[model samples]
Target: MVPGIYRPRAVDRTLDRYRRSFSAIAIEGAKGVGKTATARQRAATVFKLDEPEALAIVQADHRRVLDARPPVLVDEWQRHPPIWDAIRNADDDGAAPGTFLLTGSADPRDAPAHTGAGRIARVRLRPLSLAERLDAPPTVSLAGLLAGDRPALDGDSDVDLERYVDEILLGGFPGLRRYEGQTHRAQLGSYLDLVVEKDFPQLGQRVRNPDALRRWMTAYAAATATTASFEKIRRATTSNDGDEPARTTVIPYRDALRRLYVLDPVPAWRPAAGSLGELGDAEKHHLVDPALAARLVRATKGRLLDGASSGPAIPRDGTQLGALFESLVTLSVRAYVSAAEAAEPEVRHLRTHRGEHEVDLIVEREDGDVLLIEVKLTAVPDDRDVAHLNWLAGRLGDQVIDRVIVTTGRAAYRRPDGVAVVPAALLGP
Candidate 1:
């Protein structure tokens, strides 16, 4: 129950389940999400390739790094890309299950020596979910809902809008969570600064204009939880001097940020069921952690409470708090879904071409069945709130295994119409 002590992550279950059956597993996520700590838990021998001495040894010969005992942890394996092929070759030479555990903050700029298809399975470690942050035992299960069992939803959380805002500003990054007020904001600023400065160059994309990159990132942060087009985002980043970076410059900027795992945009869902027609192709923008977005825009608790909008004056539905709340819900739901499904189901957003309707998050199973979710910042949702979910249910019928409205409400329960209402805190893996 220590504040910063290792709270078990939802992804731990997935790691445990797969580690015993796979020779190698790669854990990927944005920096500061605790990838190293999580991988260290399961590793017998760890080579932190980020450290100069450790990286030097590996650079001299990857075999020295790979010759360790079973369950050897290669922290930041992407630092020395050859370790991937070495691990793959070891797997080919009959490496035992769980022999190598690799943690990567970013994908290698160049492809690894081996593709690591069947040899190494990949798992993502996202920011801490609400359940993990609260250290609360989950009362409602995503797996149960996905099973089409109509499981009873019942639980209550003391977390309210104010506390949710605090979480959003404080962020779910383990290291940054301990600070508060200006200190918390400062740490988040530093984290983003690192991403813009060090993380990008390390990934082989030297940011020539750090200020311009920061402006673009701030603009993207402003677009969180909305399906804003890249053109609008580009416009938002236009400088006071009446200049905007060209498409060629913007492309590498976006690519570098994504490679660093900073921009975690939710792709628009394309249902195999063609009945859902003319879906929008725009992706919903989300920073890896909402706190980063809040910090980039200098959003404070008072500013959020007073309903002050942050960041570029981009058009978006609802207030900044609401979009952040939705981002929080999306983050937690994705974490839980990843833990529950083990394979990390396709988590995406839904929107029509002409701005007709939108679903907050769509979780699709491999079989093409989908779980529909709508996020509401309000404590209680009325019929009007779930209208889109109801519309989707009517359109997709039985294909929607279940519909849910994730809210900031206190209780988790189901409506008579079968749509489950879950408080963000009460719902988990």
Candidate 2:
């Protein structure tokens, strides 16, 4: 176990649930999101696949090696696909419970092409959200209001926007957190190199020019916090020759990044009552860590502080930071949902045909209730800020139980219309 750090409540909650109900739990996320650390801290015994000795032992007798350690924690289980079957067999025999905790960065596509049922309970591990880092108070009481509780709105608190932006630029990766000065840049540079050199190859892609891929990654970074079409990305990266790769190439690379636990795509959400044909079908792209996006922009702390351009500046309109803020809110909400052991909430973007209205996020509950959320970087709330949410509430009637505006502002209060305007800082775990 790593010393000198408080356990993340979200992770601890997940571990508890795994111990109670599931024989095996798969903790998945992008690289450096703390899966290995969390599993190691909670597991009674751990077998690290990256170790040569462990690899040899598994290669010799996979079943014996796994069964040898009851309540085993297998780090990077994807490295040994046979072990998945072994775990399944062990579980089927009802030999014991809490026998395995599997952690992997690779997706099912890279995992031997088959993952049988009842093998594991899966959880998508994301970076430490702002609320998790702050160890925020339980606000699901407020979240519960969306389910028809009509709870009182918790007052908001002040947050330093500049520092918050810095956190975002620095990202949530634990490794990057320790480095200072140019060392941080060097570390992130090495990270990019590994993604291009090592990770891409592992995903079974044959890139003749890794440098070109790196360039494309940089271009994507510049376009981060915005809704850019994949075709546009292709045009930006493709060579003059018609022989350039298709938009399909972008998907694999993006998926590989996602599997590695980096890139995150924010899907557009339309109101359930609205006609599907009216809403736009575009997904806004966001890096799993906004700091990754900042790195992609090639911006330094000095550059960001100076408000100077490093690469192309991401627009500050409704489409850019607004989308990023929504993604941040989603990440926070996901952490909360996972901690509660409640039904997983689905996040969707809202839009209409005539462009009459739009909402940043729509959290769809399992019971068909919807919570409409709007995100803003500004602290001061205005009529324009909750305009879309109010419109949706009016249209959907009681179906929209809660309307919230998450912002960087100083105070949290309820508006006359019963919508809550909350500051991001007060949004705790």
Candidate 3:
């Protein structure tokens, strides 16, 4: 969806770099996350497969893709899974570098015959990050912080708690940026409705109980930022056939949602070597954007600001705003690291097996160094707030480069104990 202005995303840099060397780069993400727009920027020719005429043309002869100019974009290639093989075959038949760009919204169950391994390079295009949203010129560089240098942390932000809550509910889906008030709310609701009503079926998965799926989604939304088990979330809804939802039924719903890039769960952090001492392997549940979670839980600005817990009850540590704030921070951090050209880093959460101490995010570099982060709702970092950070820092010693607290406060600075406190709006890639 090309929406007038083309706001730069963190993934743009990665996509641009990969396109020069790799002939086929598949930009994959959820629907309406600017996949088409990002790919269109670098594409010499575009195949709009979602359109009827374009589909007919492509279906007639997949080899027609070979005729387009360099950087030929196959928008929604999943619309025709054969295009993948066609592209791969073209690659084998001496296609030049930067020749094909594919964008996919849904990962079809019947995937392309070829896994495209060593042939097609895949890049994820997620929702806009905090910095990409251009809320404020990001003062702190995540890349800089991850460099293990004690960078001078200093920035001021007017983005208070209330504004952060609004941002959380508004979400970071770039296409929905222009809509406001009732229209915006309606669009988000319709987005969720479409996932249940249309997206599920289009993925070739049958939703026997749409209401149950919606409730499950809502319940999953409630479990945001928490490691709520699938069983707990599944129990929140009742199937049309009665009795608790079966695993056979619920697994499809979860798998389909994942294929749609709707449910972005953060996998538990496992150290490459030098064990973190029995870490928990439970994945943290998070929607693609926290705003989706807010929407599913019907978290209004007033309700969120008032700290009213909405939607199905799932065990969590803090207020509704706090969870979404962590989620908002999670999205931003993930985007930042994804764009980082440094030695392949990843974003993960850390929790001990016993659950005594946990870090909200663990940005670990290729060398086993880590940036421990804890997201808090308040601005200042107290001793109580930095307890886990301090504990992990002492345990890891030199491996712990930076311990940070992402907040909705007005300023960014470091505590005497070396834990940095940064406003969510001021942090960037």
Highest TM-score scorer: 1
Each model's TM-score? 0.97, 0.89, 0.96
Candidate 1, residues 277-320, lDDT tens digits: the string is 89899999999989889988888889888888988988998898
TM-score of 3: 0.96
Q: How accurate locally, in lDDT, is each candidate?
A: 0.87, 0.69, 0.87
lDDT string, candidate 2, 327-349, tens digits? 56666666655654466667777
Task: List candidate 3 segments past 4 Å from native.
Answer: 1-3, 238-243, 273-275
- lDDT tens string, model 3, 162-255? 7787778888888897888889889999999999998998898989978778888998999999998899998876554566777788888999
Model 3 misses residue 344 by how many Å? 3.7
Q: Which stretches of candidate 1 lie over 4 Å from their true place?
A: 1-4
For model 3, give the 10-residue run with minimal summed lDDT: 236-245
